[model samples]
Target: MSSETDSSLPTVAVFGLGIIGSRCADQLLNQGYHVKTWNRTPKERADSESDPISAAEGADYLAFYLKDGIALREVFSSIQNQLKPSQTVLNHSTVDLETTKWLAEQCEEIGCSFLDAPFTGSKVAAGQGALVYYVGGDSEVLESARQVLEITSKEIKPLGPVGSATVVKIATNLISASTVQALAEALAITNAYGIQPEVLTESVASNASGSVLASMKLPTMAIGDYDTHFSLENMLKDSRFALQLAGDAGLETPGIQATSAAMEAQCKKGHAHLDFSALFKAYDTA
Candidate 1:
């Protein structure tokens, strides 16, 4: 909220340099934190290298925006011994509640406190430093890391214990994936009848049917401008995870089932690397 961040800014080591991670490093640097980055894949920046051990050694905060819990475990397990107990490990991956709890267990075993802090927003939100983080950890630990996190978040919701953030993340993503599926199908059906999608999208925007996601993706979907934002592969994995979560809770989730099936169909068609919005191509755009 303040232009001035807390005085206790720590040197942050960012692991994983994907769309979200790179944008995080940029914002951290913008906030004047001493930022060093390491990707599993090497980069040429002076502060970035391929070595995780060296990167983990010097920083007071280890921030990860990795693909999943397995990747998080492998990277940290390799260097967990070297990490100081005082350092905080921030996991920004959108994973299941169990995975989040399990990773937190591992971090605790190695004497480092862990924060399961998954996020929302795409590359655009990340680059603009407007990402929203759903953090599941102690209030004291959250404030301890708040200065470093503020570089990239509009809100840092401390949603109770270690698995809470991930639970929220998966639920929110289920909504997003289901919306994308419905919106894309509507566009496809309209096109099949030779009606312009522009009319449908415009009308939807004015009525109760409009959504933040539809507005963002609909224009691009109409023109087939499917530059990668969130990929189809990630969307499928997220949808399946949500459905699995619902099943685990002894609840039936028919909507998530349909959502997962649509995503699987899209991924099977070899559009996995493209944006999740590329569900537009999964339709009968033929």
Candidate 2:
């Protein structure tokens, strides 16, 4: 098992080196922390091994940006027995509230502090060390980790106790999906009339219906190609996550339900791995 080699600098063990996880590991390294990186597929990056338990064995903080609840659960279950009281865990995955709260309870039993710290901004923001974190945990834990997390974030907001950050992440993604889909519908209607998208972009920019989501997606929609910042698959999961949360609260969210359906339809059409902004192409009447 790997352990902190240097006592002066903090040691961070990172698992699941996908886009967000990889960038966060780099940011921690840049901040002068001893970074131990691991991934299921060891060949994806140099110096990263496949043994997650060993990577986290003696780390001060263990961070993860895992794929989903099942994957995150498996990793945690594997290491839960080995976790030391001195370690803290920061989960950056976008999972449901029940699972996150369950993790909080489980980790607490093993004497490891846990934080649900899902985030916003894209791979672009990650590359630039400017992602925004939505955190949920004990207040003192959030305060202690704020500076370390800031190594990859422009903002770190504590929403409430465990599971709150996961809810906020789902809510924000639902809004974002609706915003992008609304812009797609508007552009498709304009295209039906032979109106240029440049004209539509200008109109939205000047109108009360304007939004950052629409503005950011305009250029991608105009070019008929997406850059894959956030995958349609991930966004679709967020849409479903919103519906599940609403159901748990006994609320009927018709708009979000419809939005989730649209997202599934787009994903079913093989756009699953593209930038979710490509949902605009679902409305390309031309």
Candidate 3:
């Protein structure tokens, strides 16, 4: 039915209107794709549907950008029997590996193709349509979804079948959490020694250890500006998923383990909803 609007573009139904989903939905609409959107709490948007089933009806691509595996599963179950074999489902949330595989299996049971397509990039990237997707699915399924995917991504890196992207995403988040924790410790040490926070930030930027993440996060952390590009709680959830993967392989990841502990402390102190760089707040009292 959506093809009636534009024969070339498939109708896309986007679930979740959190930071990334909301922006991506806007991008799809702006690009002339017929988009149906739904958020659990309901948002005042013209494209928003009253229920998940309504949003998904007759959709060619059903994209989920939910908070966690729990939310994803709940919504998918509500619409599972209604799904047609012609539809392709994309999971863009970074959730546990078990959940990722579960989603794939469920889709297969209904004869619908599924893609484990969690992504990287935060609120700003979503707004700019520059998110990078780490996709895991059959190449043909990917090609079928490419045009809609490209509406919100700068690049699509296809890794392999069904669950690879989720693994890569969790591993990458472990590094990010550890890196921010290290940056927080370094900033606290330098500031205690009569060194300016900005100086340390500049030094890191010029050092071999510098990164795009540091450049963007360091200055903000220095001033206690944790403005939620990605929430501390979301990063904490991903870190735990990483630990689970490592533990299953009989490996110890002390760095992310310690960082997860720090994030938990910050979350207890009521900073969970802030940007993940709020890890620095753990040292604000020290």
**Top lDDT: which candidate number?**
3
Error of 1 at 31 (Å): 2.0
Candidate 1 global TM-score: 0.93
C-alpha TM-score for every candidate: 0.93, 0.93, 0.97
Per-residue error for 61 in candidate 1, Å, reads 1.1
lDDT of each: 0.83, 0.84, 0.92
Runs with alpha carbons beyond 4 Å of true place in candidate 1: 1-8, 284-286
lDDT of 3: 0.92
Ranking by lDDT: 3, 2, 1
> Candidate 3 regions off by >4 Å?
1-7
Cα error, candidate 3, residue 95 (Å): 0.8
Per-residue lDDT tens digits for candidate 2, residues 160-257, read: 98888999999999999888888888888888899999999989988998877777898679778787888888888888889999998999999878
Clashing pairs in 1: none
What is candidate 3's lDDT per residue for 104-192, written digit by digit as tens? Answer: 99998999999999999999999989999999999999998898899899999999988899999999999899999889899889988
**lDDT (Cα, tens digit) per residue for candidate 1, span 16-123:** 888889988888877877778988888777678568888887788999988776787778778877887788899997766777877788778878778989999889
Return the TM-score for candidate 2, rounded to 2 decimals. 0.93
Q: Which of candidates 1 and 3 is the stronger one according to TM-score?
A: 3
